[model samples]
Target: MATKGRRALRLLGAPHITVACLLWFGVLTVWGTLYQADPLHGLHGAVQRFFHSWFFLAGGVVPLPGVQGTSALFLANLFASMLTRFERPSRAIGLWIVHVGLVVLFLGGLLSRQYGRETTLVLADGEKASMSVSETGWEIAVLTPGAEGRREVRAYDVRNLRAGGSLAVPGVPGSVGVVRVIYAAVVSPAAGLTPSPEQVTDAPAASDPRMDRPAVVLRAGDERLVLLGEGPAAVLHLEGGGEAHLLLRRARLPLPVSVKLIDFEKKFHPNSGIARSFSSRVEVDSGGRAREVTISMNRPYRHGAFTFFQSSYMDNPRGPEVSIFAVSENHARLLPYAATLIMFAGMAVHYLPRRRRT
Candidate 1:
């Protein structure tokens, strides 16, 4: 048993694993870059398949491990090396800190990938919002119409579900069983001579997920309903008189504070239509204490654990000026900076003494 444990530790801390991971990183870099040049699969698609996913099919046939898988392997290697190789010797002290720093950085990346969220909040001039929504995720919102044109909207989570999974919609009788899903669907009116349901065919996924219109067939209370995400909500007549409206829309997260866009300003270059700089002054209201802050290209505003950066500006031809803010909630973002400093100190300890002696 001791011999087997030693062998396993040796394998985990082997230099070949490091070399293979580094080489795979290079390969993925080149492959993702080449793939990004394709119009259909842009940077987002490339990153999703190569960097974000645990596995991706190469050339649509060969299954290969992605960056997430390689990162996990490298993390294991670092931990094993720290346990089995690095010791309390004075000369090894710097190596110990370096390995520990690397582990911290890697774990931070993993935590950010697994638990962190990236959401977007769009505000037109003079508009305020307390909700930031997911860019590529969708959820089902069930609406009930009330008296005097008032309606109650309640959203349910569908992001964790697959085609075979079920979604528990509140206020509804039965759980919605997902029968089929088309991520990028082309919805067309029924074209047959006889009466039939609409035709939904899968199309190539849009580079921006917001542009993709999904179609889903759901089994809800013995009624099989086909709903398209782009159009009007599918209605389910209630036994108690009124109807329940169901629509799949972008998932949203309510913020603790409300943000209102005061004004958006843009500066253009001399004699050119190109934009030189742009910024948005926004009011953040928390507990009725409102404060105005500027968010620009280089500067991000932080409130509590949330950080908002000015991500996009749209000068809508038909309406008001729109400013989009990228909101990130990653508590582990500071770990990488701390790990970098630790690594720097380790490198100084490892090299400075040798330099002085020489």
Candidate 2:
């Protein structure tokens, strides 16, 4: 009687609970693999639509407040139920670890997406800015009158400073003139190469009296401002309003702290031209405490809660300079580590053979 009851209970649970868990995992795997390759394409949309509809139904069934961590909770419960029903310790441990890892990964993603901040800092040969813009690509810079009473400091959206577009200030009539950007291969002053025929052909007429250097022209109403690349700084013209800004998409860095690239070194294989290693020497000053660190390809430098990894590289006339550090910090990183260990151990025990006595 007991055996029959046990079998009956297993049959009852298998269809709804077990099948649901399998379906969820299968869908998640498929979605993850295909989402990146082609996001807006066919199966991706179908999968998204299916999940949306299912989630809607799930919302109706579970209700709001109770469903705070519905997906995670559901997965955890399913794993636990299977463990209890099957009496398979190794399988249970593996499932538990995998579920825990998923939970951690999800939590990490949530925290980073909601609270993570990123930005880039563009430092001229010797110039520095008071603050770094956020890297997610939108910026609003406010340029106020300086202490000297001369409005020297200019702030605006870097994204709005496009090659061929007029910018207008609010309440200010008219618009800034679009600057023409021409690309030409001039005689390399350092290399002493002759100018290409294309450069000669495309050169503006001497009668036009154009600026020799690369420049951008800004015309706000009757006022005209010319910004040249050879100049110390770009001149941003403002109207009567104190709040004149430009919006541009650039990498942003945190304020009060500045990163200076002291030196960048790259090492390559002797015979083969393949790169062997690269490193960056940088100085980071936070709240007056200065520290110097070297960041290498795989090796990351950690300070406080933040970590910086050697990410990319670029070559210039001076030398090859590596872009050191993709920085990030997250609170829930350990959960995934723990879950990985558990999953590996469980799988090992499940697969490996044990000695048997006759």
Give the number of the best model, judged by TM-score. Answer: 1
lDDT of 1 by residue, 239-276 (tens): 56788888878788888899999999889999998999
lDDT of each candidate versus the true structure: 0.83, 0.49
lDDT at residue 287 of model 1 (Cα atoms): 86
lDDT of 2 at 29: 51
Count of residue pairs whose backbone atoms collide, per candidate? 0, 18
Question: How accurate locally is residue 254 in candidate 2, as Cα lDDT from 0 to 100?
Answer: 53
> For residues 1-358, what per-residue lDDT tens digits would candidate 2 score against the true structure?
9788666556544546546655665765565456435634345343333332334232346532111233444545544555446586554555554545555555554454445554434432223343544433332232445556754323444345565676544434565555533221132344222222222222432211122233344555565444332233323444664545332223345555566777777789998867789887777778778788787888776655456677666665684443535666544445456656766765555445432321
What TM-score against the true fold does each predicted structure earn?
0.87, 0.47
Lowest lDDT sum, 10 consecutive residues, model 2, at 205-214
Weakest ten-residue segment in model 1 by summed lDDT? 189-198
